[model samples]
Target: MDEERILERERYQIEQIRQLELEELQVEEVDSDDSDDDSSSENNYRTSGGASASGEFTYDTSLVALHSYLGDVEDTHNRLAFLDGGAVLKLPMFYLEGVVLFPEATLPLRVVQPHFIAAVEQAMTQVEAPYTIGVVRLYRDSPDYRRPPRFAIIGTTAEIRKYCRLEDGSVNVLTRGQQRFRLRRCWIDVEGATYGEVQIIREDSPLRTPREAVGRLAPLLNLRSNIFQKQPLYSPRACRLGDWDGNDSDAMSEESFESELSLHERGLHQSALFSSYHTIHEPTSSEDEKLDPDGEVHQGSSRLDNLLGPLREYNTGRDSAKSALSGNSGNLSFKRMKADKCALDRLREVPRAFWPNWVYHMHDSYTLAQKAADRWKHIVKAPSMDGFVMKPDLLSFHIASKIPVSESLRQELLEIDGISYRLRREIELLESFDRVRCKTCENLIARRSDMLVMSSDGPLGAYVNAHGYVHEVMTLHKANGLAVIGDPVKEHSWFPGYAWSIAECATCGSQMGWLFTATKKKLKPRSFWGIRSSQVADDTR
Candidate 1:
């Protein structure tokens, strides 16, 4: 019996040795494959004319080039099935605080938690669909509260585009947001990883306005152009050597020209000239009497002259002065009024179905996307606007992701599934952000142009507090209608080396933002404002 047992043990040891050898061989083969991949990539880079002596490949900076690169990255992930109303999917959940991931937006993460690492590994090993996870924002009443986090009902599906495991067993991953889903049920497993059963949210169908409505809306293109055009609305005129009509022969004497030029330089020549011309050309009473056959004015004229002669003369002088100062102001005002009336008439003539098309023509994907890209460029100090994804839904989500607003507001935007509705909301938000004001009093607070983006991300940023809750902030260099509430306190401030004080709107006495004062005197501005973007009123209407 002892000899049989010994033989069995020897056989077991031999099997173990064979298994170890196989693992070592597999490791060696993997290392060799990695080296081959590296070599192939280097050769491809060189062939593409991107190689350098420093061993770094050059990349294109244009938006078109960026879009192509991102498209390739997206193609690597498993394509998700088209979402329908009743479709249900069980996915691993990644809960985040003060973060809302929008579709088509890329989110980079460094995962170190053990449970999360396991979840990623499990996801990677899935046979049916790998590289997909559910992401939802966690919510708590306060930052310092210690309780099981409540997650948002709406969540986005994220596809892992790139991932690498580090020596310390942590993972760095880049993920792209996909379709939105609603959490039906969620539970924490024994290993502390959360899993959710979610139903896919159906996206709104694409709708276009009728051709006639589009024609009506065509005028709006010019309106948009006028709003967004980079050139000055009124060009400033420079002094010229010729006469006003550009005829050298008709030019005034040097002394008169100098007087006129001086007035022009002071921006008062036209008004003064118009007033003097009207005064010198006043009609005589004898000429007026000759025109009247009965030598008597009509009753209407007599009444009007008696009632409004003084007022009319006063207004004529004032209006003449203004008209001369701004020669095109009246014309422009008249055109604007006509345009508005025309728009209203057209709107009334068109059917309700045509309104959607009208909106589409005015806020086309390209136009809105370009506007969004321009905003990002302005915020990030980039050379030019980035290429926008072709899909309208994706484009809207992309803009929402980049906008510097509160997390709650962004989450609210994410919850809306209609493409047109989402785009309209984004447009409104963008327009309103151009000017910040108090919600209650309608007093101007700050200009969006004066916004200071302090985050490494876009203008909006999330800061985790001591208790692990996150707060989103939008920073600004200046504001109005706000008064500091108390002395600055440095404890638990979001900005390091800075103290903060509660600030309220001076007009309405409503809470607005915080006054962040530098703790160190060397900071350029001694103080600045960090307003809650959600609290600002949407005055675009």
Candidate 2:
């Protein structure tokens, strides 16, 4: 059987385990009230960024990126699936900045996550987007810990409606929650864990506006500021930017709730400090805003850059990939070079890793190295550099937390030349941490279900299998897009990548994973293979 088929079976097993776990967790939470107890269950401690009195919100988003991402709206088929599920998710449980993706609704969010930072960079530098993100509750310190870990529990189905890399490296995400999905289970690859499957269990109702709750979002904004100051409610910045009307909360009826809240709702909605909370329509203006953060860059420029960046690198690796495919091993040729990309245009939301944050000139260094590799052989192909690793040491640098695993090792990896015995040994060491984070922020895609994927804007290998399952690691001959990777006929599986069907994110143009590859692979290439996430069920082990 092909690798995807095997992964499908593995994912099946995971689904069964999660079903029982969720059921049990529900039963256990019936009368629990221990704040510190289940608080740490998944990831529950939200940041100090509660609703501020003066609209103060600091994201430490030195890692933010303002970039345009292309993502497809959850079509009618996907929307209908959610209505049936009644889904609402609370993820990264440590503390979720995430919201519900109601059908027909779009949300704009500011993200400063490490993985997302990387994602934004890729979107700007590589032209990627409209991908799926796995969000689970912060359940690190829960009692029923051993059930089955899942990144999909009560997950939100989202599409990138708008994304921007702020001037401060902060990211603004405009997403629409299409539906809700509950975890069945999650499969883990030797490299990392992959989402097994989810049950679309929520149907969305029209965003009902209770009359009294009907005010141009300005009043509601003031009321929100007064109430949930300590809870995970809106920040002043969010309220200002987020256009909402009164009672975005349908949980309470306007008539009785309004009457009861009369004295409280007086001038301030007068509803004392005890309230509430709150898609995505990409207007032409917003679309233009997303694409050209400051109008300095164009969509074509970004896409061409992304497409060229990898193909250029592939050309350098052409010989080895070709040799590997043809079963030939040798004193492979290699190159020593540098490639760097400056935010020539003041792109606001560049990821922190790429921003001049951790290591100065880091992105520049990488880009230059990549460019060096590309140009080293341009007019006249350089034999010495072809099969060689491009800044292998720099590639492996700890771009994640801005710390290197071993400066010496990275140093050695970079200085070394061919695949000599010494180079081979060093390569192995460099290759040690092959698994990329599906939980991303820094040039990485955080782990998720099958069919979902991320590109290798970083080392270890871009294009990680975010589905959180072990990949079949198919060796392809060229750089390709998810469309080709997700085709069922190509992989011969019943499902495309992991979803029954998939669509690319229109905003960022990140190849939403599936069985397709519009990306061109110059010579020798390889790709990861896994099951589609839509098919997962109770894989209870």
Candidate 3:
């Protein structure tokens, strides 16, 4: 009942905004002197936002209201998922600055520009039930004006969930990211709207070292054999199997080690290599349970001890022989003792390649997932992880959507091809992402520990300006190397109870972002700094 009442109130507010837009549109029409402009305007509403005779944008004052009463609105009830199965799509492109959308993130846009408004309407009127738009980040520093604006080759497809048309013909759209894509080509149409032919990117499944590979790695992990396997008298593998009954048995041969795995086992191992190609989440079969319970092949040296229990008993006998060799007076050991100690010393000189890279615990998906979840807990305050660590693929996207980093780093995460690779990259970035610096001059601005979470989306969030430029900014409690340039203005502030002032780099005079101060006395944060992602340096590299 409470939800219904809240939804009803939202509907009322939307109707009120529509009525206000109608009145504003009527007032603009009355102020205009050209009466015949209505017929021509209706015929060319789509073309007005596009290229004109002078190759410039035709700003329509009649479409914009004096003020917008609408706040960010999203339709979560009727959400749609994109599942075309890795097919290519031709979609309308919306290039934004400092914004990189990952799958499952939400983007709110105000379509005040004529070209964008036309794009929104075109998406809505399509035959498809769920309309999708390709969103790419624009490089704001690009100086080439003759060609199209430089944008990222990689982008995310956003499905329109809800849209509201205003009286002046502008639109407010709420979209949710569905899938990632690689832009093949992009061009501007005759009506001035941009379109792109994109191929959807398919992420590889979470990785796992095969059970047969674990069996092969067992010989490398046998620490006891590593110490004394070269000795003519002491072979741990032979002693454990009763093949060495103290009659000077030779050390186990490499040919025997290779023959232990049958042809059937080798075939199974080869098939497991490409198993991740077919599906995102493969079911765990009974054979998969043979691996370590934690999915980590090498948990500790204790795991090595547990694998060689029989050899451990044999080692006890060798220890007693060594003790007997020393007299009650504790005399120096003979040649055998010296050889044993030398082999023990050689243990420290084991080649790293002998252990094999797949045995590393850090390369495991579940291990990386848990580390990422723990790191996220240390950074953010609320929202329990609740089973997120179990799904490494989902957790990778969730962290990429909200991690407080520059747009370039976020785009790198989006372009990552594998789940384990993405998680590893994120963990490395989270560990090293300490300070935010200026992108142009590399001047230190603020520490990541000083970041303030102003939104549910974490320390960084996307907010659009009056000119329809979306700036992804990170909120910080304190910042340096910045100079506030203008008096605080409360109008159109992204934060409801804050007034904003332009902020610029103190050394280079480049526009950094805005300094926001709370207008209400009761607001908890008295003041904060917003630094644009584009201006921030990509220290993750």
Candidate 4:
């Protein structure tokens, strides 16, 4: 069986390689035809700029030659069958620095190391969910020198979308993150490849707009249901970032619910504050318009609050007395503040059936989703976001993945297991992401308004170099605190119309990113900067 599997895998790879070569040929033919028309436009643009300072910088030399990226395909057909089963899975682990993959995000990787290549081969031959691996961030605990690297417990599993084997025995693989997992334990196999026992993290159902508020949110929700008609309603048990295959509840074992039970016990929802009070008033149609739109159904009228306000004060006084019996006010106050922050970080395990009349509508998932999407539209450019807004849960991941925030902030988004909480935090980041600075020395690089959208993906994009290193960089129209090294090199440029030069921090002398100058006179922005995300810090509160 092993021998047959190996032969079968080899045959499959050969066929895929051939298909990629054919596609490359087709792309080259199309580019060649387009270049003739573009050359004339380039001449006109240079002539039009005549004698200006920017025009004087135009080069007579042609634009950088474009390189065809081979074997790039979106492979979303392969469903992860084990996720819905609630079973512990063992998968090969790949660690990267400053990378946190979210479901549905594309991650292009080049494998040259011997052990890693072997690990990929093993994944290809697996009987179940072949070509899947756990991708986790490997980072040091502190800035202290020479500290050992540690892999994060939370990670996303990536499925190899397409791959090409080079003559040098290296592999260039395009993969997409499929689902999030918790790394329970890790070990090195006999072949020196790392593997981990992982559990699928079941994310909570997204907090949706209540029926009463559905009409109020009609403008935003108009394009929601019809667009997702073909897609299945989200199931908590369904594998993320893929089509749902209806899973039976019986498939889950008792052990699968253990973590959920513990999680529910720890949550303190707003309703819990007055759970014993049974005086909630249900407003009729006549009174509906008088209802405080921000509050839930049980909070439709002030009767609920009028009955419990004094009781809450009494309980607070009693709790204060209990605290008075324990410690000094200063220490007690500080501890309480710390506890509140910690609780806010986690998802509410037990959802509130109804919130108090004083609660704000900003806490609603639909409201937060609209706010996040609106903010994103103003800052970044991408495809239509209508579908993303339809599913607030997926919108959070999509925004988190493409946002130009630092890796620390990106990792925090991945760790957040709740939808509404994630959206709220993202909105806060979008509002405060004003400046970009060097991570090591805190030197200012650029402002949020200076961001340039060069790639259709977004402002920040991942490009893999010839050396197999994937750099996630954000393009900007202007940058400061950097020195360029060596002459601009056009060879192997990720942007065909630009030549890139190595840029370093002027103050700290660390490599910040690259400065890309237009090789053709026609390219707009004559020059721009591609700052590496790993090397920069952002205002991420």
Candidate 5:
């Protein structure tokens, strides 16, 4: 079937589909069509059969509405899953910030640039009307960009949505998402539009979690909103996940709670909700306390142990925490509301021990813990990220930004087994750089508030200025009246073998901070690093 002929059949189906609309349509649990199979309509690639000879087919949800839902899928418990063995795709990296599919509308896009034009040429020669178009999401501010681009494989699966050409040499076409897919690999074209290989995805079903766990976390979301230090303002309860609008359950309006959630990039807001929940819950513990049935303490050797210990005993058989990962079970090609409900409930019951490792190591752990430990209540408000209000907790964007680290140095960080050692070495070198040490190197301890700290890498981030201070230049060390000097390297109290590191902005060569060094002998529990000349432009600013 050719692209134009298939589109003509789609046009006919749209009319019949409207008349056949029901309260809710049956979307195959996970719509997957793999060409490697028999090339049937039920798979990824098909030579024929999506349409009938009379040009009649089923009408599903509009692409636009589907796209809206994709954006709003909140609660990590409800995310879609990766699809394996589907038709493979090769296309230019979509540069558009984002693209939406409008069910019946056959969109016309120009394919002018060389590599993309070649992609179209290849597609034209294929047997299917359209092979497959992967619509991925992008974060770009090309004209006056503040940061490097962020691309994620969270796009819908679309068969050939439609195709048309104008008098111009560009390919005019309509593309639609048939299902969501992941980017297998991304590489730039000779002309620079990013391109990649992608695999189609299918929505997952409800995950398993202990019933007692849900019971433990749910009401507690409201009970001592302030004390669950392990959870932050962005947690579900803080965002009124505990007191969600009843109408939102099945509501289909533009402003329904679910719709609003699905549309927004929620991590930052979830962070806020975790913050808000703590304001109301005044609990005694800062850590996510776990309880064993026999009332014995469960200080496991590792996190997975602590998380699974009590649950394993309670759920000895098949009926265990089946709710923990419903969100990942592949669907017929779509997900259900009931499954999402189960997943959310399981998240509530997750033991502090079971939480992901990143939670323990995050930079904001202590601040979040302090919010929960104090159980200090603030306003119970669900602030949406539509306006993006809070200051970013960590120095993000700096990860990929060109720091002093060379390609080999950066690769070492990537390959390192011990995260702390990598950081310590990087800090030591930064502290020793010539440009890093300034007049402020002396009296570092005296100037505390302005310095940055990393405590235990702990629950509250207790230490300050640990990374960027010119410690040796500062005079906390007592200066004896002994002028018996030899080599400056061995004699100077402040001098380590190397220099300190200075942090300068990559976009503009302005100084951000200085990273101080600490060897085993110099390891004081409380030493910190300092921010140097604040002449650099911070995106946050």
Candidate 6:
């Protein structure tokens, strides 16, 4: 009777999935047909070079405008424009410290420096190109901080979306990161305005099928599955696997049922679904039982246990010999070897042709965008993820922007162009971000869900100090080991009426962040904390 019920549930799930797939196909077919008609019409207009009776431009004014502003904006705007990979283009440059922009993310700037103000003005008035500037980070360790400070090579092109001139002559501008680029050469004009000749970094072709990506992420999925299994609350089979009376039927709605079933299916497939693509076979029941009960493998060890035992042992032996020769006495003598390199290489070698057809299928199967958006919603303390955009690149950049990590690590993520690679890295980061710790004392600080994105731009909040240096901070709702110093001072507070007190990590006696308390009785929550992203350790790194 139980077997029949399980089989019936599976059939029901498959039927529902098939229905959803069919609906998606219909939508795509309609979109494709409409796009074809529009393209044909556009071709006709281009050939005629005149306006149509229906008010459509025969001469491609938008294309002409894009070309006039930036030589080839139409070609590069939405799509991965570079076919052969990189191209050199001269563009106005803006330098910032401890901030890296990602594509589709927004960066807000308070332009006070004369050179930057001039750059913004130049961008605004330029008739040929759209208002765009190249953003590069100015590292403090660089030799020159005043005259064209040493900047990072990898940067992003930002399009000025909005700008306003303040009474003090400073400019407040909002810019959206468009694409990643590598700064090849930079020069400063006599007026101190900087210019960079940058090569646009092309993104990887979105050809990996959902199956292929899932296959690549098999180990991680399996690990997550095991974790979910251990935690009954998160486990999909938690209710079903236990004794349940029919009275619980009132609690199971269609949406909840679908979500549970989906999670359950994902768990089941994680262990064995991707095994056929690689040399390693599925583990036996006894071996599975013998695996780590906590579901965690050692650093640099394959999740599949003996999958690369020979290579790992060889590396282990080499490290042991080195340690013996050096007279090292601790387990630290064993350097963790990268066990995922072989797997990553294999994934990269998968035929590109297998991806394009599978792309939509994967999107339909896994719902990456929706899942990511939901996670972001919780992280940002938002009511819903509805306002968030859902494209892979956009979602990835959005999460990267809001994640409370050091600027250096964010910069590393910004430098990575491959969509899948970035998404995978982000997923790993998100997982670790759940429990933030102090870098100095490794004390537990904030949880990922406790993060509050107070700023519109990203997680990092910018504040100009009295001395005029801008500092970026990440806001958190709660933390541990923090001691508030003195009374909260309201003067020069960024949030206007709210007062702040210096907060230090109690364990190490190092400054961690600030505790802001509401002075007005109306303000809810009463108090919160803003931790410097630099002070937190990036476990992903």
Model 3: lDDT of residue 494: 65
Residues 1-541, candidate 5, lDDT per residue (tens digit)?
6957955764564443333322132211111342222323342322211111111212121321121111111111111232454657665444333222211212224456556565555554444323444544444434246778766544444344335443555554444334445578878766554567876543222112222122112222323323223333222333233322232232222233323343132333233223322322233444543324322223442432433333233323222234435544332222343443343345454332223334433323233323322221111111111121122111111121112222223323323322233333333333332221222222111121122222111111101122211111111111111111111111111112212334323223334333333222222211123232212111110
TM per model?
0.44, 0.19, 0.63, 0.62, 0.25, 0.51
Model 5 — which ten-residue stretch has the worst lDDT? 455-464
Q: What is the lDDT of residue 363 in candidate 6?
A: 42
Residues 380-499 of candidate 2: C-alpha lDDT, one tens digit per residue: 131223332354332222221111122223323322332122233332332343222211112222122111212211111111122212111111111111222122222221111111
Candidate 4 vs candidate 5, lDDT winner: 4
For candidate 6, what's the RMSD? 26.8
The C-alpha stretches of model 4 lying farther than 4 A from their native spots are 1-82, 143-145, 209-360, 381-384
Ranking by TM-score, best first?
3, 4, 6, 1, 5, 2
Per residue, candidate 6 scores C-alpha lDDT tens digits across 1-541 of 9958965764564453333223311101112322212323321210111111122212111111111111111111222232235766777898887577777766667678888888878766555345878988766543244655457899988888656677777766656778888998888877677888888887764433454344222112112223222542222232222111223333323345335334444444323323433463343324431213332223343444444343344345556657766896534334433333344345333432213444544443225555566665655544244454446666666667666787767887888766666666766665556666777678777667566544444555545443334455787655666665655665555543346677777678667778766554433344567787656766543
Task: Estimate candidate 5's alpha-carbon lDDT, on a 0 to 1 scale.
Answer: 0.31
Best by TM-score: 3
Please say which candidate is ahead in TM-score: 2 or 3: 3
Off by over 4 Å in 1: 1-86, 142-148, 210-386, 434-447, 452-541
C-alpha RMSD between model 1 and the true structure: 23.8
Residues forming the 10-long window of minimal summed lDDT in candidate 2: 273-282
- As a TM-score, model 3 comes out at 0.63
Q: Ten consecutive residues with minimal summed lDDT in candidate 6?
A: 64-73
- What value does the lDDT take at residue 129 in candidate 6? 44
Report the lDDT of model 4 for residue 79: 54
